[model samples]
Target: MEDPNPCERAKKWLQSLQKIENMNKIDPREAPISLDSSNIYEGFVFRGLQIDQLQEGRALCTFKVPPRLVDGNGIWPARVIMSLVDNVCAAAIMTCDKPVKVSVDYNLSYFSTAKTHDEIEIDARVLGHKGGLSTVVVDMRNKITGQLVAQARQSMHNLGGLTVTPRSKM
Candidate 1:
């Protein structure tokens, strides 16, 4: 007999959550993110990212630095950290079913480097939101020594289902 797929199970759980009419009233942390990209791009970029825990506007995100993502010096690049931070920021500010938001402004500060095979944990929190914009802060730390690796402050604008400009095909 074949063992059941955990990914399939997770999708089913997310589906059940979507069925609830009061999904927005439920604690945002309680929502399980789906892995399907057709449903959301956050899931696609965060394919291997894990949400260890969350509360209110804060989330604990974990990711492993794969060998393929390392730069020439065998360290993860700042751009990678920025991408992860942006996603984590979105996760911190929005709940399931909330309209997707795009990063309008983002900034990063690197305190250290992460080598291939390093396990990283990010603490992301939504600082505030006004009108159509939300401000988020994230601190990336090494899970092993708990040293700070990078930090980011991002501003996002809620697009509210408005179509986005598509990137030109290469």
Candidate 2:
């Protein structure tokens, strides 16, 4: 059954994420497999992501660049970096007491290269909200050297008074 209260749903989702973060090793047999693009991307990008802190309108996370995400030059690809920024920003936005919003505008800047096995720290914070739009900024930095890797600013639009239903299985 679907939870009617968005807050409760959000809380449950966050708790599940926290639980996953605390696990030392995830059993492959217990892992869920889905054809959903969002789930697939999340599973791939967040395999080594660790949630260090979470609060209202803020999130701090750490991730190690995996080999699968590296390009031929042995550095993180732009798409991977962008995906990390977008997902982290969305996680920060989810900390707020509002329904999930869809990204309408996303601006990203890459500053440095990240190689495989490089640890990156991610910090995301909600800038503000206007009417149905919320803005957030995410910063990625080298955990060891503190060099900035990338930054992203995204604006998300909330669909007020709209009921969103899940797509049924075909």
Candidate 3:
């Protein structure tokens, strides 16, 4: 059953994220990017997503596979998976409190396909860091059976000192 209290849900999610960050020794300043209506995560939220887990170099997002994102044969398309990879990779990087990065390269491999309305989980992690580049790996799976759906590797270029933030809080 779902928790009726938004506060309770937020608390549980925060605790999980905190535990993972502590275990991995991630920077305290890093935080999970929210699914604001104006953000890309809003797309996932519109499709019925739930943040299952998150931490430095790792994240677990669960959602019901929407038929609209699938092909005629009911197979989840590569494009959608690619977008997921990009977003999850960004989330993984967001755990570091570093400057925003832009994806320069993405290598994705598909192992299987998911059906419409399937409960699936996408897990992503920062695999390594070198100089101004970051490498991330992502995997999609069946939430119920833990079957692999797809795997992806993405590399992003850190903008570093070139990044610009809002002048003040909203």
Candidate 4:
């Protein structure tokens, strides 16, 4: 379920944004970003991220893999991994306040691996954004299994303006 009142949500965003801005180092372009998970979707909350820090074009998130995220054969679904990576990657570069964005390309490299009920951590960094294009990289690894299920680098295009909207799981 989502908190649908834009007015109330905006108030919460401003309050939290101000707090983060006051105590943390941030960039000018990131002023409007909100770290509160209330803005994030519930599907992502299935794995749930433990966000340690948020900086302009940078973020660190940790996920505790649950058995529900596993497929019937006892393997983590590639879609699940991809979704996790996508959420962090998008959020990492999101606050530039661009109204519209489209994923131009995404490249992922799988190293070790992740299993059911494992805690995975990912670090995402924005590489660059020129014109309307933005590029970012994410490093993902299973904390307990010490396996790297996948890492992805993506390019996105900021469409026209920034409009924060709830995205349902695809």
User: After superposition, which runs of candidate 4 have C-alpha atoms over 4 Å from their true positions?
Assistant: 1-47, 95-100, 161-170
CA lDDT, candidate 1, residue 137: 86
Against the reference, the lDDT scores of all candidates come to 0.69, 0.76, 0.68, 0.64
Q: How does model 4 score by TM-score?
A: 0.65
Writing each residue's lDDT as its tens digit, candidate 2 over 1-170 gives: 76444334444454343233222344546544333456555566666777788778887888899898899989999888887777677767777876667888999999999999999999899999899998999999999999999999999888886877889999
- Best of the two (2, 4) by TM-score: 2
Predicted structure 1, TM vs. truth: 0.67
**Candidate 4 has which clashing residue pairs, if any?**
98-161, 98-162, 99-161, 99-162, 100-159, 113-148
- lDDT score of residue 170 within candidate 4: 95
Q: Which residue segments of model 2 deviate by more than 4 Å?
A: 1-34, 161-170
Position 135, candidate 4: lDDT? 86
**Candidate closer to the true structure by lDDT (higher is better), 2 or 3:** 2
lDDT of 2: 0.76
Report the number of clashing residue pairs per model: 0, 0, 0, 6
Measured on C-alpha atoms, candidate 4 has an lDDT of 0.64
Ten-residue region with minimum lDDT total, candidate 4: 14-23
Of 3 and 4, the candidate ahead on TM-score is 3
TM-score of each model, in listed order: 0.67, 0.76, 0.67, 0.65
lDDT of 1 at 102: 86
Candidate 4 lDDT, 69-151, residue by residue in tens? 67787777777777666656666775444322578798988776567677788888889889988888998887766677788
